[model samples]
Every structure is written in C-alpha cells, then in structure tokens.
Target: MTTQHLEHPTHTHTHGPDCGHQAVSHGDHVDYAHDGHLHREHSGHWDECESGAHTTHDGHTHVHGSDCGHEAVRHGDHVDYVHDGHRHAEHDGHYDDH
Candidate 1:
C-alpha cells in the first residue's frame, strides 16, 4: 500500500490598529476592505455610538469593546465577496466598523 500525506489548515491573520489591509479608514469606520476567508467570528460594534447610530461591517473585520457576531457582506464601499454566498448590499454610507 502507498502512503499519502495530509496537509493541515493554515491560518495567518493580520489585524490591529495599524493593519495594512485597510483601504478606507476614518475614525472607527472602514470601507472597501477584504480579509482572508478563514471562517471565524469577527468583531463589530455592539454598543451605541452616543449619537444613536448602529455601526456595521461590510465585508471586513471590526473590533469592538466586546465580542460581536459579524461576518460581513457587500455593504456600502466594501468590496464584494459573494463568490461563496455570504450576504451583500449597498448603502449610501459605509457599514464597516474600524
């Protein structure tokens, strides 16, 4: 019998205050950004922004004060990633939380 080798799943991520993957960023808002697809729960805005506004993450990652369940889709200036079917939509404003 011949022996075969199996490969392990690789995971390499880079996200932080100064992540280079960021395309458009302002204060705590990001747009047109696309990170690798690794199937993981990303961060998002959970609390109010004092201005009674709810932040959203289009097709990118966003860290929050607490853990948030945000996968992301094509919203606003965010990049489209419907190749595998996640969810997408376009708005007048950005839906990404820096």
Candidate 2:
C-alpha cells in the first residue's frame, strides 16, 4: 500500500514495523517501522488464489458459508496464487504448477 524508495536503486525498502503489510525487497535492505513486524511475500514456493490452490491462509479457501465471491482476495504474505482453489500465483514471472 505504501512504497518508500531508498537512496540506492537496488536497495528496496521494507514496510518496516509500521504497516501490517508485506515488505517487498528488490536488492537493497532498507529499514522501516510498521507496528512491530515485517511482512514479505513468500519465496518461489509461494501460492495464492490465482494459482487455484486456495492456501489455508485463514483456514478457509472457497466460500466459507455463502458465495463470498473470493474472485480476488488476500492482503499479502501468500500472494502467490495457490491451485488448491485459488486462481494464480506468480513470482518474478514464475507461475504456480497449477
């Protein structure tokens, strides 16, 4: 949601310990404060909704009770689309096995 460009181009800035979102890293490691924790997208083994895995993020993949229409969900961390029931998961152009 917030992007802070560091001094160095390659030096990517993290959301720090302020916001409760995932921190994206390009190369450089910048310090930030978002509450008290840092979030980063999952590595290559990541999965998300697009992948169709519907990872067990909140323990619920598809509609919990009714047609929630989870067409596109998720805040971060597991942005990678899981094939379990999700739609897609892409990292650096790497897509999910689904």
Candidate 3:
C-alpha cells in the first residue's frame, strides 16, 4: 500500500490591474484623517493567524477567509458567518434574537 499527502491548490484573484501587483503584508500601516492632521488607529497591524471576523475601530465588521477575500458587511444580529463558502450553523444561533 502506498500513502500520499495531497495539498489543496491555491487560487489567486486580482482586484486591480495585474501590472506588478503584489500581496499586502500585515506589517503595513496607513494613517487616517479625523479632523485635520493624520490620526493612527490600533497600530494598524494584522496577525498572520488571525482569520475569520474582524472589527475595525470605526465599528465596522470585516470577514476574511482563505477561499474568499475580505468582505465588509454590517455587524449585529443580521450578520452571517461564512466559512469556506459555506454558512455554518454556529452563526444561526444568533439569529434567534430576531
């Protein structure tokens, strides 16, 4: 008997033109404007192991996945958690409030 380990194929999707486009590293940081001068928020760093849902300082929700890119949507009772292109029942429990 022979045993083989198969690795999942990685798929890449480009948002902008493919002209010398590269992936953004988590160490990258950007400044935001509040009133006049530029303001910094939350160190502007992202964790490599940090997957799934994320909340911004502005109270906005974002979801990230290996299969799907980042998606912004309203959080709260109406939000749904999707994993690998499938909606899990874990998020359905929160729907009871509605």
- Work out the TM-score per prediction: 0.21, 0.19, 0.17
Worst 10 residues of 1 by lDDT: 44-53
1 or 3, which is superior by lDDT?
Answer: 1
Task: Write candidate 2's Cα lDDT for 1-98 as tens digits.
Answer: 12332233232443444655433332233222223322233332221212223222333323321253323324244433223443333434343322
Clashing pairs in 3: none
- Residue-pair clash count for candidate 1: 2
lDDT of 2 at 73: 26
Tell me the tens digit of each residue's lDDT in model 3 across 1-98: 11122221231222222423222222233222212212222323311222234322232233343444532222223332333332222232221110
Superposing every Cα of model 1 onto the true structure, what RMSD results? 16.8
Number of the top-ranking candidate, with TM-score as the measure = 1
Candidate 1 TM-score to native: 0.21
Compared with the true structure, all predictions reach lDDT values of: 0.31, 0.31, 0.26
lDDT of 1 by residue, 4-90 (tens): 222223424443546554333323433324333212212431111111233455554433222344344423344333222233223
Scored against the true structure, residue 1 in model 3 reaches a CA lDDT of 14
**CA error at residue 25 for candidate 3, angstroms:** 2.3
- The per-residue C-alpha lDDT of model 2 at residue 33 equals 21
The alpha-carbon lDDT assigned to residue 58 of candidate 3 equals 35
